[model samples]
Target: MNCYTLIKQKILAVITQLQSNGGLPADLKVDAITVEPPKSRDHGEMSTNVAMVLAKAVGQPPRVLAELFLTHIQEFDEVRTADIAGAGFINMRLHPSFWYAHLSTILKEKEAYGSSDIGQGHAMNVEYVSVNPTGPMHAGHGRVAIVGDAMAALMEKGGYDVTREYYINDGGAQAETLARSAYLRYLEALGQDIGEIPSGLYPGDYLKAVGESIAKNYGDAFKDQTEEEYLPFFETYAIDAMMDLIRDDLDLIGIQHDVFTSETAIVNEGAVEDVMDMLEEKGLIYTGVLDVPKGIEVDDWAAEPQLLFRSTQFGDDVDRVLKRTNGEWTYFAKDIAYHFDKFERGFDYQINVWGADHAGYIKRMLAAVKALSDDTVTLDIKTCQMVNLMQGGEPLKMSKRSGTFVTLRDVVEAVGKDVIRFVMLMRRNDAMLDFDFDKVKEQSKDNPVFYVQYAHARVYSVLRQAEAQIGQIDEVQLQNADFTCLNSDDEIGLIQVLASWPRCIEGAVIHREPHRIGGYLYELAGAFHALWNQGKEDTTLRFIVDDTKVTLARLALLKAVATIIASGLNLFGVEPLKEMR
Candidate 1:
């Protein structure tokens, strides 16, 4: 169903025939051959660099090779003409029937039309929104959640067995801080006049309910207990409460993880020691002093030797310390063990969606995965940059109710889940995004989400109008319509875009860039809107024409547009609206 792929295969077949006839060298490499849309529509429908790529190897000039390839390619019935363009590029124009038949495929296949099988069912673990279990998720975490979930969906569409995961950061100082924060709330619930929530403790009002729940469950039982005894109990309770809060926040935005891995559980299961021992056996672990990182001014820097991992051998900039001088395992030690556990779970690929602040950690994490899987498994880390929330072009400060940052729930409540998810993915994950309250909710072309959804709504409206004006046109009638009547330039251009859906999905999955889907959806929407506008200018271009045959064909095309839009929106976890209101 991918026209570009189909054309490439045809070109390769011609090259193979030429090789057998000694028209080209047998050993010429063809892997670099690519067939894509011509840079300018004036050139041709599609263009390829196959001639230039194979010319040197086949002992011929690029122009000579281009002419030879063009002669053979033009012989195919699907191709109307093939011409040599700049630098010996082969540009091709396919017959109109080819595009019309592809449009028919789209109507029949509907939402499943653009699916791909490139992943071959490989297990891929996409870990995202691994924010600490200390508080509710923030705006940045919302971006990560949307990116990861969309990526998982994209990979799933591309035939990968995807597991959406969240790694809870509950084994560090952050969790302890959360526990202390909850304890203060617990004291407040008991009517204690604890003033101004000590500087380091969480001061969000959301924890007040957790405190009340704790009091109701255990009734002054731990009021007299020492910090050592009560801290553990409170830490466990607070973490559970915070996780519940986080899940609720994510639920508002249609995000739910298949797996929620706990760092403490990994440590408790001796995973850290197991991985350290394995690395030690490979001579990657050692006791050594490390130089301070450049530009870091540590007031209490230590010079003593410590347990370290030889990560430099695996392409990391420096050997990392597994355990500090105080003998506690470092965060990196637990992270390494976590990835080893992921490998042992039988995933062939692992993807981590991290905040932009964690860019420096990518190399070390990749090194850990490489060492653990012996470079057999692939790990791709996508770092999501900051999201600046704005109201009328002015940046908004942290929520006073949330204490530190604007909660994900705050944004989702302001703009519904659909807007939040769609707008978050409108940019590349590594690029900074501005989420404007006034802009995203606007019902104009300026808002990508609204524009795309309006396209779907417009399609539905056309179908309704067509049914009321002309008699009802069901699936069978639409399928049997004479698509050859769709000879307008706008119609043909739209078919070309729709025919590229499978190729777009494949490229997006291979690049691990879900933003590409958003971009493609916007482009498809624009083409659809353009065609709709064309119908307004020319009476002959109207979808619901006097001719029943032409009307059915145009209806089929509009349905195909809606089908693809719904398909792409589903991957983004956003609903395609049937009506704009």
Candidate 2:
């Protein structure tokens, strides 16, 4: 059902025939050639640049090669017209019969129309929302989480054995800080008048519940305990509570991770030491001093030797430190260990979805993966720009719950999970997005999620009307839908858009950008809405007509639209509404 792929195959057949008959060079490489939709449908339904790709290889001008291909493609039984555009591009208008036939293809394929076997079931690990288990997630964390979850879904649709993962930074100093922060709340829960929280510890009201829980369980048992006596139990308790809250928050927004990897477990199981040994065996680790960052003077600069990894050999700007002068493994060391664990678990591909603040950390992590896997496992790091929570055309103030920023749960609760998921993903992951409360809440075309959902609901409404007025259009009738009844330009144009779903998904998965699906769905909805508007003006253009055949044909098309939208919304983890309230 992918027109581009179908046309590309036919053009390849043409090239092969020409090669066989010696009309073109026998040794020409056709892999670089492409067939795509033209800038304007007025030019043609599809276009190809085969001549431009192969002209120089054959020692001929591109226009001459274009003419040769045009003459051959004009003989295609399905082609209505074939013309040469500027230089070497060939534009083609396929017969409406060609597009009409694919409508049945849509009904037959159903939700599997856009699916692909690109991944071939290879294991893929997508690690995202790896925030410290210290507090509730903020809007930025929510954006990353949604992007990662949706991207994983997209990959799964593309046939990758995808696993969504969350790496908890519980092994670091932040977890200890959280435990100490909870201890203060614990004392307060026991009727002690603890003053304002210390500056370095968490100050969120959300942690108050964690402290109260601890007090309720162990009333005053460790009130006077030292750091060594209370730190272990408190750290474990706080992280477990925070992680449970995080899990609940994720559930509130309809995201569920397949695996939750603990950073402390990685370190506690000697993964950090094992990862270092593997790197040392590969001669990637060394003892050296890092140069001071250029244009930035350090007040306490040192030239002493330290443990480092030769990350520069693998495209990083500079080598990275594995161990600090204090003899403690750096945070980067733990990250390398975590990725190594993913690799050892047999993930052929790993993707990390990080917030924009972590952009500078990408190269070193990639370098470590390359070094450890010897380029066997591929790693891709996607960064989601921060979400600007706007109200009345301006950024909102900090949240009272998180005490630092707007909590993800608060926004989801305010607008509902569907709105939060859709608006957060309304833009490219690497581009800044404005989640405007006033705009998304308004049920207008300006709201993309609403527009898309309305398109879906309209299709269902039309289907209901058609069934009641034109009699039941059963599954057999739809399977045998008379596509010739759909001869109007607008009818065919919408079908053309619908036919491109498989191509859209394949490209999205290949580029590692599922944001494209949002744009595609918007365009699909626009086309569908345009046709619905047309039907309103001309009764003959209506989906339900006196002629039972035309009514059934158009109803089949509407069903296809609903199916595609539902498939897309399922990937976004958002519900596709059959009726909007």
Candidate 3:
């Protein structure tokens, strides 16, 4: 079904025939040969570098080898012509029938047209949105959430067994701080005149409900308990409430993790101790006084002897501390155990989506995975940069409700879930994104989400109009259309874009970049829009011509465009609009 792959196979067959006929060396390496689209449409539809790559090996000039290969390849019925370009690159033009048949394949496959079996069922664990369960998720968390979700969906489409996961940082000093903050609110709920929240405690109003809930359930039972007695209960209750808030924010953007792994649970199960023991056995763990990190002033830092991981052995700049001088395990220690647990669960690959602030942690984390898994598992870490929220070219301030930052819910509620998801993915994860409220909501071609959705809506409108003017044209009728009537350049150009969907999916999956799908969808939409506009000047170019055969063929083309759009949108978790209202 992949036209490019089909063409490449024919080119390879011709090269093999040439080798048999002594036109080229039988021992020449053909693995490096590649078939791709020509740089300019004027050159040809497809181009290959087989001749150029094999020329030096075969003891012949590139042009001479290219001519021989072209002579043999031109024998194929699908390739209308093959010509040698500069330096012996072979440019080819295929028969229009070759492109037109892809429309039938798209119509039959529908949303499944671009799906492939590249992963071969390898288990991939994608951990993202592991924001501390201390408060509502912010805009940065939203970006990672969508990116991770889309990546998981893309991997699944490419045949990877994907597991969406969230790692809760509920066993740290931050969790204790959250507990103390909730306890203050709990005192307030009991009618205690506790003045403004203490300097070190959380001051957000969102915790008031958690305080009230505990006051109602336990009554005066915990009113006079010591810090040691009440800290555990408050910490557990606060984490649950905060996690619920985080989940609600994710729900607004259609994200739900398959597993929520708790740091506290892993620590309580002695997993951290076990990992430390394993690393120690392998000589990766040691008692050491680490050098001061670069960029840190000596006067502002103090070095303490502690248990450290030999992260430098795996490309990190320095060894990392696994336990503090006070003997408590560091966050990195628990993370090492968590990743080891994932490997123990039998995942072949692991991916972590982190914020740009955590870029320095990548090497150490990868080192941990390598050491713990004995190089049996591969880990890929993606870092999402900051999102700058703007309106009318001015940066918007923090939300008054959240106090500290713009909550994910605020963005989703303001511009809607579909716009939020689309705009977030409009750029790659490593690039900074500007989310303009006015511009993204604008109903024009400048807005990518609207432009793509409008294309899909236009297809539905055309179908409705076609049915009303030429009797009902269902799937059967469209499939029976005389597709050979689609002979114009515009018609063939659209099919070419549609035919690249599978290739696009494979590329996106391999690169672990879902933003490519957004780019492809935009290009596909532009191509369809251009063809639709062509009808305005030429009456013959109109989709609904008087000829039933021509109209049916055009309808089939429209359906194929709509189907591919829907398929791409599904990977992004964005809904395809049937109508633009």
Q: Report clash pairs, candidate 3.
A: none
Alpha carbon lDDT at 299, candidate 3: 93
TM-score of candidate 1 against the unseen true structure: 0.98
lDDT of 2 by residue, 341-420 (tens): 99999997988999999999999999999888889988999999988899989998889778789999889888999988
**What would the TM-scores of all predictions be?**
0.98, 0.98, 0.96
Which whole-number lDDT from 0 to 100 does residue 552 have in model 1?
A: 90
Clashes of 2: 0
Number of colliding residue pairs in each model: 0, 0, 0
lDDT of 2 at 398: 86
Worst 10 residues of 1 by lDDT: 293-302
lDDT tens per residue, model 1, 356-460: 999999999888889888899999999999999999999988899899999999998899999999999999999999999999978889999999999999999
> Which portions of model 1 show Cα errors greater than 4 Å?
297-300
Sorted by TM-score, highest first, which candidate order results? Answer: 1, 2, 3
